[model samples]
Target: MKQLLFVLAFVATGLFASSQGAVKKYRVGIFASLYLDSTFTGSTYKFTNQMPKHILPGLDFVQGALMAVDSVNSNQPLEVMVYDLRSADQSLDKLRSRNTFDSLDLMIGSVSGAEYRTLADLALLKNIPFVSATFPNDGGVTNNPFTIIVNSTLPAHCEAIYNFIMRSNPTANLVYVRRKGTQEDRLASYFAKYNKGSNGSTLLKWKTLNLNDNFTQTDLIPHLDSLKTNVLICGSLDEAFGLNLVNVAQKIYKTYPMELVGMPTWDGMKDLTKPEYKDLSLFYTATFFNTGTVAATNFTKGFTDLTNGRPSDVAYRGYELTRFFIQLLLRYNTQLMQHLNERTYRSFTEFDFRPVLNSTSGKPDYFENKRIYILKRSNNLVSRMN
Candidate 1:
């Protein structure tokens, strides 16, 4: 789903430089993929102001970005350029050939697969900070210091889960419950990375509980212990698997003393408020979370006034990222990446973009937001665990 990332390539020519206090005019590119062709029928440029569903994600993102641009209290000319990926006039290939974003200083996107690879290469070649907005995987691009993946990866999620589990009683029974899938293998491996050579032998007592798609309460209950708190780590990226697992767990949770840990993808299933999930305390990881703040309240009010609808999570991300990065541009300019860890410009959600190094050169392969939030949902209420 994160493929065809509607990227907003905010640019500034040549160094995009500015002194500590002094500022100059800069150009910002909003490279979004609106899929405009699907919006209309036959050959017609005429379109209504109302947005189609296909373009809502990109539109919401761009709206938040534009709002952020307007919010920045700067007199300097920060030119905003928006590009539609599916448009004939500004398609990805067309814009690339035209060198529209060749001199970009930073690119914020949720791009993945071939598109992500292409954009990451371009950012590396041009020395632009490619900020991947929500693509969880890196797409195997390495040795490029300019790449910044905002979403925490699977391994990062696993690590967060492991760390959270370790906080419980070391004698607690840890079950890596999952279905038969290739991704499940990777999840198990990631858990093994932390489980191996740590905390003296198996004080945490780890075990694998492989379940089928039609797994029932009996399939899970046998592995769980009544004495120790049963920590069931749902080791599948599949939502169906997670839902099925939850359905089963919720039935047997009262007897087992359960704490169900879920994959990062579980963050998307918003309707966990159903009665089935209430008795069971479900845990998942996310890169973004807002308990609500003054700044967030202001943004929500401004966005509702601007769009006449509630802003999406992506919209908030766009605003927070754009606002924070622009502050960096104003403060450090071309040296933005040099001081990415600077605590000066804080966003509503915390971002910890740590460097991932290349094995050969020992240099930064790319940067990734290693900060993962473990969230809990219980009794139709959700809260951050860490």
Candidate 2:
């Protein structure tokens, strides 16, 4: 009887090993700017007291992705590997020389500049899905269907802003305020190109107010009309300019019902939530937003429990996108590209992915998320208006 029990246990152990081995395992690569070498030296700490501000975003993003990988309680086998692109001993050629990406099923990057472009190109060459997690620009990687840009481009943001204006308050008095600079002028050009696509001559009429050093309410009141709703578009990305506009608007908007729309960068402006700016109605565009859904709420709790702080937008993107694409990788395997637009995993934000095409060739450039959320702030509280 003892021999029979030992034989049964031996058979059960063999079966468990067989099942574990039979499961298909996928190799996933996550590249972020962790700056590991700079922070650590042979297990010794470099900055003992506090982490540098430059490395915080990358650390937070990687932490979120690690949480996501742990939360994936599926039957499929997943092997995740994280590479620090900003490490002292790291470079694109060094990574490639080691054949680090040879067996990768998918790659995700939280990097920009040359690293981003290299990964995108590598994904194209290898026929693997390389998810550009944070960089807003396309980085000139054209005709690559394997590249998926999670962060919408500047032009997409401009289009979303124009669409919001036309749909929300088309007949309202439109005023575009900007400060003169190279980047600011370029943004103005983007708006002009997108705004011209609408039908009718008088359908979209906007007057530009270029703010200077001597700018004040006396210069702004001329464009605002007290009789109708004044929709002010802050066309520049300057933080000081945005704050000045808020001060001026607060003084004038008590008389006029005004809504101030800002650029995508304004989403990161925590100062807008202060008590002094509470009364002003403000709006801005962002790629990802958590509105306290069950999943999002749980993620926040889990993140806070782990780090004792709330997760930032980049962290949330890392968690959501990692979970999302890994699920797809397990389910669809190598054919994930065919279902790029499918709404399978509903995370914090509903991603609206559309194919971007090359201008001259008219072929598929890459997949991009065109949807931008317009968040509204009033009375010291913020909510998604769209």
Candidate 3:
């Protein structure tokens, strides 16, 4: 899903800048995969003036950031510069040669994988605050206090899931339904780690139900408790598995009280709110969700008017990240790290950047957002439970 990202081209715009002032101008760099090179063949447009579906998310992110930039009513000019990692000849050395980091106060990227790693290293070297807007994984980044992961990691999700289960369903029959795979094992271990760390007690001990890749309803029904609520945490990011799990769970829900919590990837299941899943008590964690605030409502309207369609969560995330971090840079200036966990400003999601320690080094490698939203959908209505 994160592929097809190397597409966006660099675009920069002027923000109010001042050489000397209490609120001086700050340069901000936004790196995204726009794939500008592939769009044109020496002058003729390849796609014929139409944006591809694959590139829309990144572009939407840019649009959201632009909207936030426009909304800024301050003297502290944010000289925003956008870079397309998918450029024909773009490289870290090329970017470094430009000596751009010398002027940048903050850097944000909706990038992932190797691109994320390069930028993260640059942030570490320059002591610049790098806001990773969309990537979920840390890419093995360690000993880097400059990196801030806005999208919480998988371990963070597992911890949040465990906390939700123990707090809300202390006595519920907890069953971890996972397909046999390395990823599944890793996910299970995360929950296990969290369970072990919680006061050295496995209060939320779960009955593991390992199934084949092509698991059927018969494989799950035997483990579910009909007499009590069965809280099943699906330990897989596979959408196919999640769909099947939901289908089987729905059938079982008719006779048993069941709640199925899915991984973060399940957020893209648009059909969850359909008639079939209307009464399904589905749970999932996400970094952000539309809270229907006046600002959010206006943003939705504006986004629809601009794109002629509804905006995705990435769009909201882009706006929130840009607006939030810019305000932080403006307010704290060089001392933004001192108040990294402050919850004073919010756009859609609440970010609490807690330092993530590297296991081998026993020191903070990076900061990640630990705050999670347990969104529950029941009776055709969705609400954030925590």
Q: Which candidate has the highest lDDT of all?
A: 2
User: How well is each residue in 1-386 modelled by candidate 2, as lDDT tens digits?
Assistant: 12222322232122111124766778788888766667656555577566678876876787778778877777776778777676544566877988878888999889898888999999988898999999999999899999999899988998899889999999999999999899889889888886674562444898999888447899999888999999999988888888788888888898888999998888888788778889898989998887888998899888888777788888898898888888888889999888766676657778877889999889779899987898898998888888
Clash total of candidate 2: 0
Model 1 misplacement above 4 A? 1-24, 40-51, 198-203
What value of lDDT does candidate 3 attain over all alpha carbons?
Answer: 0.80
- Give the worst 10-residue stretch by lDDT in candidate 3: 1-10
* Candidate 3 C-alpha error for residue 327, in Å: 1.6
By TM-score, the better pick of 1 and 3 is 3
TM-score of each: 0.89, 0.90, 0.91
Report the error of model 3 at residue 180, Å: 0.9
Model 1 lDDT, full chain set = 0.75
Candidate 3 per-residue lDDT, tens place, 1-386, comes to: 12122212224322333345555678888777666667656545577545688777777787788777667666665677777667655555677887978889899999999989988999999999999999999999999989999899999998898888888997888888888888888998898887775468675667898877677778988887889998988999988888888888777788878889999987878777678877788999998878899989999998787667777888898888888888888889889877887677677777778999988888789999998899898887779998
Off by over 4 Å in 3: 1-24, 41-44, 197-200
RMSD of each: 4.7, 7.8, 3.6
Q: Tens-digit lDDT track for model 1 on 64-89? A: 77668777876554655665665687
Task: Kindly report which residue stretches of model 2 are placed more than 4 angstroms away from their true locations once superposed.
Answer: 1-24, 197-202
Whichever of 1 and 2 has more lDDT, that candidate is 2
TM-score quality measure for candidate 3? 0.91
For candidate 3, give the lDDT of residue 178: 86
